[model samples]
Target: MHVGVDVGGTKVLAVELTGAGADVAVARSAQVPMPGRTAADAEVEAAVARAVADVADGRPLAGVGVSAAGLVDREGRRVRFAAHLPWRDAPVRDRLAERIGVPVVLDNDANCAARAELDAGALRGVDFALLITVGTGIGGAVVVDGHVVRGANGMAGEFGHVQVVPDGLPCECGLRGCWEQYCSGRALERVTRVALGSHLDGPEVAALARAGDPVALEAFATVGTWLGVGAAGLVSALDPERVVIGGGVSAVGDLLLEPARRALGGALQGTSHRDLPTLVPTRFGPEAGAVGAALLAAAGD
Candidate 1:
């Protein structure tokens, strides 16, 4: 069996797979507390090692694959940097391999999620598609001809950092006008707070918008427009055949997509000449990451 680990800021999910990623044997998970004094890297590594040990249970393992959140290096081994987690020029793959006593492969979480979508989720059968995840922050993965495009620095599809508005809202990445500041789940909450003078979660805001609340509707529209603008930049750069928008906020359905579609049409460089890629919500929902990690693990065998 092969072990796949999806290490997030708060939790680590581990799964055991067989039969070329089709059959599942056992699954387990563990949480890593926020590091108090020590670096979060050690805590996360410990959590992943524990999770893998629990799932392994003495069975000879094929290999290990890790789906991490960060800007992975060109070799897909080191994590150059991550905004939420504390990893700087970290040799994650080598460290994990040394600790677990097995060969380990690592990739960006967005890329892993996109690979899973291509193998078993929404983008199945599509040759070229862009997986745009709108969660606490925005992330993107570019798949061309069934292979991920890890750019020179392995951060090519980092659409979240794209500047949508010059001198706009401040981002945690130390940027002033990042796309995630306007087009992510946190962005939705920020807009709702500004427009309604109250904090509302993504689901609540969507419900209010569906009930015809003007403020909620306007917030969604604003986010949708920003999403389109950012997506327009991606389309211009990659020219992907399809754009898959996934993450927590995508549950708003057409409430967000309609405005994004309109904005994408309006912002395209040559609107009439090029075929606009279909913009749709993700079919995998929240499970894309785990499923993708499992697929990566299976592929390692």
Candidate 2:
């Protein structure tokens, strides 16, 4: 069996997979709390290792793949930094390998999810695809020529940090008016709270949208506009065959997508010409990261 681990800001998720190619089976899965942002590197690695152990179930492992929410080096062995989690230049692969006694591969969480989509989910036969992960912030990945574009610094797909407003909301990356600040889960929460004067979280807002709450619907429309605005830039630059929106906020679906579609049409450079890419939802859901990580590890072998 091959193991995949997704280490997030608040939790660690691990999955065990058996089989090959598109026929892979999910054997088991586990989740654990991640270390605090102030946590030491050892603490973070230990939490990830514990999650892997919980899911392995004593099966002979091929290798462990880790999907991390942060910048990773070109080699995909080190996590350069993670804003929400405490990791900086951390040798995650080597340390985790030492603990598990197997090979470990690490990559940006969005890259893993994108790989999952390309190999077994949304972008299956597409030659060029863009995946935008909408969560606390946006993370992105591109599949070009059947391979994830890692870029020169392995930071090519940071779609969130792309500036949208010159002097807009402050971002976690110390920038002002980043695309994620206005388009992600955090943006949803902020807009809901400020506009409705209610303290509803993301899921609560989603529920409200389902219930047809006018305020919630409007908030989604606003955020969706920003999402589309940024997406237009990506579409212009990459021109992927499709764009898949994943991560937690994707649950809101067309509440955001309809607006995104409208805005994307307006924002595109040449609105009247060119075939726009298909913008769709992800089929893999939250487990995409872990599943894709394991797939990547298995492929390397």
Every model's TM-score: 0.87, 0.96
Candidate 2 lDDT score at position 233: 91
Q: Can you write out model 2's per-residue Cα lDDT over 139-166, one digit (the tens) per residue?
A: 9998888788999999989999999899
User: Model 2 misses residue 269 by how many Å?
Assistant: 3.1
lDDT of each: 0.80, 0.88
For model 2, the superposed segments whose C-alpha errors exceed 4 Å read: 18-20, 23-25
* Per-model RMSD to reference: 2.9, 1.4
Q: Write the per-residue lDDT of candidate 1 for residues 35-103, one digit (tens) a residue.
A: 432466777788788878877787887778888878889887799888777878999999998988888
| Clash totals for all candidate models | 0, 0
Query: Candidate 1: where is the Cα deviation over 4 Å?
Result: 17-39, 54-60, 207-214
